[model samples]
Target: MNPLEIGSMVKARYKTGAYIGRIKEERGKFYLVEVLAVLKHPQQGDLHNPKETEGVFFHERRALAHHEKANIPKSAVSAFTDDIPDYPASLRTALQQLREDLNGQPASAYRDLALSNMDSLEKDYFG
Candidate 1:
């Protein structure tokens, strides 16, 4: 690859990929680039906010330009959650018992429940 010159637009490939503004400074094999456009990746949070990441230094292997092409395809990135717990049968049984207790209540008791539901709605929405 040709050495990058100052004030040249570039597409830098990292975990995902990004298009950036002109090259600012160089230190050995790394370039300090002004971030322009951040391409999205599935596993990562939003990196496109310029206020958050103003500029970044990238190695030559990760930095590219319009004239050049990537030799290897980008690696697949993803996020996975493995700690989610299953709902217990005891909790289900407790819910069933609560439903049964409510079902046996008289009409006036249900009226009170209805008023409680309305009160909850008012407190949540109007407060």
Candidate 2:
């Protein structure tokens, strides 16, 4: 229930499956994740909630983040499965290139690919 549990997983309404990231707190408010991968929003194809479809926003709230908040709705959240898919080779290459280009440019570019198995990426790239 604690959003800032450091190594907890969570599912956001926008993302189809779940996310694996460390929880972090800033300015007294807790964030569900410290690092999350880009995912296709659940409402991507839906005519409703255009904002979610456009991929402009990504993130889900955890109970710890809003435990005392009354304005936010309380709901059960799902944790991401380790069996996610990794990004395609083409996309991965492009992302690496982009990161190299933007290296040391103030912005930190980290790659978060969704793969059914977490080891897929390492085996493909690192192996």
Candidate 3:
């Protein structure tokens, strides 16, 4: 499928809930995104290691695109969605493996990191 078509919904690897956004293209790839939101993180309150907190506090319209593996930032992500049918055993297995890999990490960690990185990229590229 042409990835950059408008009205297409894609799931970001980190952002939960199906990201119902349109696809945008840059140089030569597609990104799926929705209205941007301000994300906040709670302060850890550690003296030795100051805690960091952030969250989606503001809403802004934005677009996302997919980049080639080599061109993608260390932070760039692959699209995800729940539309996959139940018959794809191999794909399901791979997803299961990924779940296993993330099983032990704190749930908030993924959102915190992905949102932060996405914010930085947005500012750098679109600002």
Q: Per-prediction TM-score, please? A: 0.30, 0.28, 0.23
lDDT of 3: 0.33
Q: For candidate 3, write residues 1-127 as lDDT tens digits.
A: 4433443434333222122222343334434344221111122122233223334332222222223111222133333354532222323333334344445446665535444544554465446
- lDDT top scorer: 1
lDDT of 2 by residue, 12-126 (tens): 3323322233334323333444334423212112233332424433332111221221111113234565643333433344334433433534432122211112234335444
Cα lDDT tens digits, model 1, 88-110, are 32223323343354356665533
What is the descending lDDT order?
Answer: 1, 3, 2
Sorted on TM-score, best first, the list reads 1, 2, 3
In model 3, which runs have C-alpha deviations exceeding 4 angstroms? 1-4, 14-20, 30-32, 35-127
Indicate the residue-level lDDT of 64 in model 1. 31
**lDDT of each model, Cα atoms only?**
0.36, 0.33, 0.33
RMSD of each: 22.3, 14.3, 13.5
Model 1 global lDDT (CA atoms, 0 to 1): 0.36
